[model samples]
Target: MFQFLKRDPVKKLRKAYDAKLEEAMHAQRNGDIRGYAMLTSEAEALWQQIEQLEKK
Candidate 1:
């Protein structure tokens, strides 16, 4: 029984944002413009999520 997994949505979103931000920058450097754009969108969405979570 793995009951120790805490549900921290904000933390989860922050991790995702950080990862996506880094990924976006990397993609931009690697000539994958589309991947960079998509990842940037994901990062923006994550920031929006963080804002919403903070409002709650």
Candidate 2:
């Protein structure tokens, strides 16, 4: 019944992953290695979650 009102977790994760990648790129370009690495790791985790959701 309320399925239409529910948001897709994968879709949300994908969006967040994209944003993280973009931020990571900016951080790298700014020479913030630590920030870049952190964001990259976060993005990778989100990718893993997205993959798990896709496998279902």
Q: At residue 49, what lDDT does model 1 achieve?
A: 91
Per-model TM against the reference = 0.82, 0.90
Clashing pairs in 2: none
Model 1 local distance difference test score: 0.94
* Residue pairs that clash (backbone atoms under 3 angstroms), model 1: none
| Best model per TM-score | 2
Candidate 2, residues 16-42, lDDT tens digits: the string is 999999999999999999999999999
How many Å off is the CA of 19 in candidate 1?
0.3
Predictions in order: lDDT: 0.94, 0.98
**What digit string (tens of lDDT, one per residue) describes model 1 on residues 1-56?**
66668788999899989999999999999999999999999899889999999999
Worst 10 residues of 1 by lDDT: 1-10
| Global CA lDDT computed for model 2 | 0.98
Lowest lDDT 10-residue stretch of candidate 2: 1-10
Q: Which stretches of candidate 2 lie over 4 Å from their true place?
A: none
